[model samples]
Target: MASWVILVGRISDVDHSATPHKIITNRDYLAHPALFRGQRPNVINLSNNYGYQSRGYYASLLASSRGHRVIPTVETMIDLSERKLYENALPELEQALNRCRKELGGEIPSRLTVFFGIAPSKASDRFARLLFDWFRAPALEVAIRDEKGWASIRKIGFLPLARMSEAEKERFVACLGTYTSREWRDSRTRTQARYSFATLVDPNEELPPSAISSLRHWARVAEKMGVEVEPITKKDLARLANYDALFIRETTAISNHTYRFARRAQQEGMPVIDDPLSMIRCTNKVYLNELMTLNKVPVPPTVMIAGPADLEIAAQTLGFPLVLKIPDSSFSRGVKKASSPAELKALATQWLADSDLLIAQKFLPTEYDWRIGVLGGEPLFSVHYLMAKKHWQIVNHERGGKPVEGGFKSFTLAGTPQHVIDVAVRAARCIGDGLYGVDLKETAEGVYVIEVNDNPNLDHGCEDAGEKDVVWQRLTQWFIDRLERQGR
Candidate 1:
């Protein structure tokens, strides 16, 4: 039979003491060998100065009565003690346990469990430190039961539950228990044989209905491949440390919360699907242009114009029928097409009125573009994006009107030419590994890179001209296989 130890402390204490006197005073159970005449099991209750009123104290007393020994411990004084009291006290507790075994005239019980009574405080405060360090032990399990009397066990690994309110913490803990103990235990035997994995999705972006349909399709694909997909938002990101990877559908900027979440996950050595570096490289069109040009990848002739004086030189280099784009803008909101020098000047002046950084490039006359979905350095699917009827942009251009219906043509295999594949591969290599959509325009000369989007739209029913399931399956399997290899 195993021996058990319980420590009770107050939620609020005026003394501000830090010590294992709670465990130390419970020494009498093991000290008195006669108390355990048979293998009925040994139990020690270490509760004192808990500030529990009559009802709470009496309930604890009744629970302790089931144990063989009940001992009380208290701290008389503590004021500005600088030393790490808990770290120092742990060794003392170990020594005292050894002494108790010696007095018992035999080896101590093989199994020992300790339960703590936690109190709220600053995360760096002494009490928090004590709970964190102690609960980190492999043999220990920490739990908190709220005022509603619902108890839950804490999951292993670092989580932000310390910042949660008592009620929230209790609910989270309870959910953890239910998921791991019940839902997991009831899973298929095959799934149980493989490594466990979890993923999170952020819903910050106001995605088009088509995009939402695409996500659901992919979710189903992932489920079929045995990878669990959990949708989350910014509010849920704070509590999502247990997941192996995160897939964010939101557009990420350097100063945004999405970027912060990615940065933190990277610091923790957890692989993020669309990593922060990938976002930084793909989101900024200017940066993408520089990298693509340096690698000799095909890109539209482009020049940067910081002010009105540079616009003429840019127009001279790129010529008329060009596109002017503002830096750090997406969804084709800050873009305009100019057919002549006069129109170019007017557009640049209006655009530069709001911001300085502008890019001018010759506009390709292609009526449609290709959105190539690349995952883990390999191209998954290619979808042709046709412009809306009478609209130059693929997205709707009419004001206060419904989104324009556009045509799509998907290919399971790389239907793009070999030269285009080679160029896209080189460009994707420069962008590094992550999920991305590269917009390319195929010209008589070669495929020219238009823009790289960090959070590209995925439409399901919009394009099914080819083996769409094959592409979805490949992507799903890749995610599952990667997580399995990482031992998630």
Candidate 2:
């Protein structure tokens, strides 16, 4: 976990003991870079003035350069200072304002104070959160007004601590306490480690690729490799700049926070598994289907459905018992099997409401699927994912949406078939090489690529069964090598 520090232009800008985190003068922090050379801390810039090239602005600027995560980042400061930059955000802000108009009561207040994403009034809590998500600042004062028949955001500006009333200061303190306490991090200390690693996870995920036990074991392995590991969630987005590298353990989607985390890590120049490019290519089956076919990678005969005409073509071409998939299906959630023409049309019409395109492929029934783990364009491990009981998929969700997974058999690289390993590596290379699980179907004819998964499962005793300690060691080294290459 990153150590926290509060930066202020003047000593009196904030109460000395208002927060448990360390407090330091802006000048002292700016003057002494050696004091924080090796460690990256979370710097809350409560500096008094943020004018261009001012002490406050430079504090945030230097914090970012030194790899410390700072609130009211340099970009945020520049965006708020220029009206044009913030004007584009007005529509969303207006929508949020209107939603809370009733709770705000009568005419929307001309102005409201927000401290650390918390509004003084309980009714504006969600609006405050949205504001914080847009502008990461210690405090903000938003101006609301009547635009025709609705509430609109007129202007927004920073709320200086020096200008806050005593009551507002108390509220700020409480909000700061609440904000800093949201992360559910492990308490173990790794002060001696050379680098910091952030493992992004969702504790409440029903079927997270990596279990908590697996994460703990990886943390232990990381410690032995002189790296510190911490489990972070979406709430820690503001703190991402402090880490040297990121490993996403949760399921990923282009429209979700996991993708946001991956993009942020890349922007920070940190090595991240399941990088944004890999997610874009792996998450969408439409893109993968075209990519594989173009690259000469063997895959099932597939048809892309866009309208009723295309549906008819797919039904006639692939025939009965074909699989239909939405672009972003995962864990067998948005995939369905159609055994007849009517079933195909019914399923396609309903699924098309959400997605513009769908994939229809010849159903190649297999007792098991060959999942080959590939790391950095090299084969890592292999597993046979047996089909669920009386089901054709590895995971069956037919019973009330609860998934029942099948058994898995792990194999060493030498033990796995050379043909399977070669095909999996070829498919993974079609997408950028980070970490991938290339799922393939083996029939009497040949092995065909099914799907290339980004952020594949690394659960303890599952993927690691083949190499165990060797797997963990290699994984840790993969991160370290990238960090070294980037001169982190």
Candidate 3:
């Protein structure tokens, strides 16, 4: 649970009777220390002016320095004040504006006010959400214009509460109540959990890293450990500042919203599982292959293919029956087996259209691939992912569009082979000391590393079968240890 406070330049700017939150003036907030000395509450700075050295600016600036999560951060205030500073965000905002324009029959109002990511009209609510994601503020005014047939963002700036009309003030109060309610999960009414944990999950994800049941199980377990666990989605990006730590349960990719969440959490100074750096390192196969080889981790002989011109060279290096993979591929979707020279040429040519670089590794025929779940640079659980029925890969995607995955056999850490555990930990360390599942192949020769995945599957019955409570306990402790180290 997180404490919250609303700061305004003038006490009369807002009707305190309309809201339950404590509203303080900028004078008291800046001069008084007893109000929020040690308690770092989520501060909502709705000051009237944000000019250089203004009280509004100082309120937010001081709140940040006091280790409090304040919206309309100094950086955001500065960025919104200058066009060049916020130009990088215009492309995405313009794209969102065009989408909203289409939703309104290719026409929309030239001006709109967004209060806590909620538009006055329901038609533009999505655009409001995107705007809030980019610029976190209490109120924002977006000016849209027609350029030919498309919509463009002409100017965007902060909207203070004092400028709102009576009806708009009522609506703004409702919006403020809605926004603060999401962040203010008081411990008195809730459980006695000392820390709030957010598990990022998507129920609509086709193949999520952790099942909803698994997330529920972890939440129940975490509650017993004095940690209030909440399942949040991608839409809860702005609310991330309220949680003490974040655990991503969705499959992570550098180009997706998962990376954005991770990066945002890192920026908020929160401990996040599968941090942005780990996602960047593990999402791309070419990078992983090079990193493993450079770290002296045992991996199959692999070659990189730039285009059709380099296909022959890759073939000569790895030979036939090689594994072909796009740079950013997961779940065996972009992975294929090139059994012959002609098939290699066809697959390489087709895959080259999507990515400039491809990875070709010697295909090691193994009955099962060993998956060692490593956390905090230590091996936690091990499983043998068997090959699909008469299929070369663990997941068979060629049979229609649906995927058929093979069975998994879980093993206690002590029951697993030491060599396998050693290789998995070493490979995972090459990436970072975060949660990971390292896939390896064992043969008569030796164990070879395949891939190090960032968000490993911790399904209810699959990964937790061997070490049920121990798994949850250690994971909870991981966050606790890091948070305590940071004096959270």
Candidate 4:
């Protein structure tokens, strides 16, 4: 875990002085990184140094550059701090201004929202936007501009302060008050953090190996690197804000709890995996095919099956041994290999009922399909999933439609063919830098992208086999790097 350092110009706050953290003078904080040690500590700026003009500003800029998580991040300071604080509550301020304008007979100059670092020489102070979130404004300042270029300022009287719950008040107070609460400490770090992993587990369903031994291994490796790891469940949504970052271990879907968690975590400014957009883009094959074809990525000859007539066009265009798949199908669940018109009709008729459209592809048979795991825009690992015995797909699920995966072979990143890696990166790039699995088929003619999936499996021994614990460590490392970019 990262350490804590309190920065103050004076030790006047007795409650703050009691913390065991190392203390540094505000002047020393403004000094460059070369003057300090290398560890990145979490800092509390008690000097109340704020704004672009303050020494505390330079200190924060320097601290963040050195990887420290300084409170009142430059972003928070610029976007939500003093002087500009009232502007942060633009909606309420605008409403107050409009009300003043209406009271003054529709004159635009009748009202305004203003801020000053010092006590105002005119008008009056009526509202305060607290440093912590949850905004409110009760009144406004009226600016009366006459034919002369000069203007006179008078108060329009702010609205009554918005009533806040006990929790909101306490949260606001604790955030700006003396002692940092244990809960806040758990969720955010003044320094580097031992992050949280959001995952789902169900006994009735089969999960990848990463859920077990790989998960345990992640914790072990995290500890070795001075990082913390915790596995959380879907029920922990309310508690998610207490963690440093979110890594979704469950399969992601745009409409599911996983998407909700990612969206919420993102709103709170925490780094997240399988970000909401990635889930939406990667989960739907229709979207993926369109994206790939538009970006000029090589894909099997494909057509959309939106109407009954298109099925005939597909048959004529793609011919026998073609494949038909539902847009959101996974694990070979809604995929079918059609060898005849009757089979295509039965499958397309049944599948089209569930989705508005389907995909038809030229079937490209191979001994196995390559699964390239790409992370942070680079290829991390590769696996070859051999087709199941007497089955056309890697996962044989035709019997009762239950998925049955087959044997897999993992290879080091360096050992995989360059063309495979290059094409994999190209496909993954169509999506963002989020973790992805690019499935491809390597044939004598060339390589063709099968699909790009977010939240690709990181099975303990399989995906990580290429580099041992390095794969998991690299994953956690990305989280750590991204977490540093968030919050103060």
Candidate 5:
């Protein structure tokens, strides 16, 4: 069997068009000229654009120089025009690869990898489908880097025959059998399966149907790709050692079960999707603000308030018409805007009564915010979120009433501003590597970090209705690829 290693580009590193050339040169030096005596090694380059200017061509040139074979997996254009029909092409991609392996004397290359080169110009429905197909193979190694420079070795699926000892294989197979049995039973019931997956939130907590819908969509996608996804509750977290991976559905804090699961999963050597360290670092507004500032990333002025008095002082200093938020909430929950001293005082008082900490910052009256999804540290997709009508928050519920409709409008990835991309990457680096959503605001001054969500919702019908399916598809593929690497 042939041995393989996968490398993904750091999305943040390639803001200029010339960055791809830099990456190609680095790969060539590391794997060919320096390590392999100018001999080419098998490489797979994954990217959205298929144009001649794309990274595929860059990979081909590098491979040819090293006298090695390079496989260019050009991802199809993801846009409103092609979003809904992407999944239909998965089987074709898989079949093509299987055929290639068969023709290569039945010896599949030991390393299959993916790179999230850059954010797409548009969100594609088929993008997710393509990712799921790529990850379905148990023999793939996955690495991801986001638009920011943060990079991580996300997962290694099945061990290559050349790398695994007989004892290691036996132990892995035993663990697999246990996980498979649980998956089999969980798949039979929605409730049971959901509770069996992983604990991001308390299973007993009454999640909004919107949240449940998102979870179901992810579970369905995982099933379609031959992975069993079930919800694991806080009470059952100790059993994490039995699984190959853990999937989290929302942002969480250091005190939450989701973080606990991540810590445990990492210790056990299981690939924890979304990752615990990522959650702890991203969920805290204060931490994100400080990190961004330290890294010279543009961020709005922010103050952390520990009590009502502290909030009042901060409010007076920051001025009215500011944004106030809890340290660990997503989907615009526990976030509010204060327009006057009286309003700020009252809101601060109430918030302090309910939470231990709050963040007060100058509100950038930008009409829209950007939600950039960084998977395995790579910016997979981005969408512009317009504030809800008659509401200041993007996904806020009414005052003691149900959520209002038409509060958000999503634009294609191409529509996002360059500043949004710059600020997003800067913010993501502060949060470390994993899967995350970098929320940003473009003010007159510049782009600022509004919040960094560790578990940004991947709801099927949320902000970007057109790209919801694709988001899940890419996410599923990420998990699948990670698992393959871990097993390897």
Candidate 6:
């Protein structure tokens, strides 16, 4: 797929001669890029007049929500639209100054802030030359009324003055006066970040180097990409400010420091992996089930065993030989298969001791489950994870399970079944366009999503076994693209 522009309205009217790029009109298909669709990430720049009536607003919003890069982003369009509707001019000239001051945080006396929501289209004309004699200086206590003495409330409609003549500059300055207000941000507190990247790794909880040489391999990749990567331990919570972006490599829990790091990094305007929203949505099976079901993503025959009474309902709905899961368990832990009523009761009682709910799913016995590693809504690598020998699950974490091992066979995206690819991508998009490992089961019934895991395993030897180099490159490049787009 080539670079596409979403020219929603009047594609014929749009003169695309200025840039040599493919334009997707209302008639063209907006493709969710396939794995074979080359290197460039799918992008859409919305080129349409945005207002309440224009389809551009909805298009921009949807594109942005799905993590597409949109020009004149949804927020910008709304800001401009609101300017035409909800604006108050403070007596006269460049009336948006007050809003800028507000955006900068209340009032600032020392530092001046100006905003250009929509840049001046045309040039400032001779109308700007006329200025009152009293407005020549920063008049702090002038009347709210203009020189005419009538009530003054002028709209902000100015043109760019980057190439103004000396005479025009003087007149322009005289037309606008400054005012004194309290400082919005302190000068001393604002400092440039010291490092380019900070990987949030818990010494005890990070993926093992055997499964993933992340510390050394990713650091090397970062180096090759000209990114300065540093390991930030749990103790470096305050030092989050020192880095431009964060990558949490630890097991994230909503109640733990990992989630806090993700939240804080997002708040500080850094591109983060396992983004806070993803962490919140993917951490709980209950949330994933509802989200997927609501969105029509194929999920297994499942029921929420929320209370003691629901156990019978689950038994009736799913019948015998079903799986029970605690909402937020990892590494095949807290997941149990109950073949009988007694086993189901025992497992439910054990899991319910912690979480308020349990996820009871009909056991879909298969040789191997499909694990699709989707990043940015496209498959990076996929694997068929086989059950352990003589075990019911890929990983047996039971008290005396056979030496804790899981088998996997990697495959290129093209070699995988289309249903697997389609369902995985569909399931992933329902969750955000972040790095996700969508685990799914392919059965005689249909392809059913097991669960969507955020911060999916990027084990160097396993997940990356197919397109070894591409897997690592894709992950690192995602950060690079995010940082560059953010202008970090």
lDDT (Cα atoms) of all candidates against the true structure: 0.52, 0.82, 0.82, 0.64, 0.52, 0.60
- Model 3 worst lDDT window (10 residues): 185-194
Model 3 agreement with the true structure over 1-488: per-residue lDDT tens digits:
67778898889888889888789998678655356766879999989987644567656755654567888776567667766546656887888878877668778778889998899988788889888887788899888888788888889999888777788889899998888878532211111123698889889888898889888898889888999999999989867888888999988875567877776677567788988768756877766776676568999998877668878887898888899998677888899999999999999989877664678999899999999999999987888999999999999999997789999999888889999999999999888888999999999999999999998888877887787779888999999998887766
Please provide, for model 5 over 1-488, each residue's C-alpha lDDT reduced to its tens digit, 9 standing for 90 to 100.
23232223333322234222223333333233345543334443432222322233333333333344433321121101122223333344444434443344544333333222111112221322244333322122333222222222233332232344565444433432332233211101001111124425454444332276567777787777776776666676656666666776534554445555665565455566667546545655645665566567887887767666676677667887888887556667777888887887788788666554568888777667878867766665676677778767666576566665333455555666766766677677656666677888766677777777776655565644646567777776775675565553
TM-score of 1: 0.56
**Residue 358 error for model 1, in Å?**
1.4
Tens-digit lDDT string for candidate 6 (41-87) = 23333333445323454444334333444444433343234333213
Candidate 4 global Cα RMSD: 19.5
Q: Which ten residues in a row have the lowest lDDT in candidate 5?
A: 184-193
**Pairs of colliding residues, candidate 1:** none
TM-score of each: 0.56, 0.62, 0.63, 0.61, 0.52, 0.60
Error of 2 at 367 (Å): 0.5
- Checking candidate 4 for backbone clashes, the offending pairs are 42-190, 42-191, 70-488, 138-158, 138-159, 139-158, 139-159, 187-242, 194-228
Task: Provide C-alpha RMSD values for all models, in order.
Answer: 21.7, 18.4, 17.4, 19.5, 19.9, 16.2
Error at 360, model 1, angstroms: 0.5
lDDT of 4: 0.64
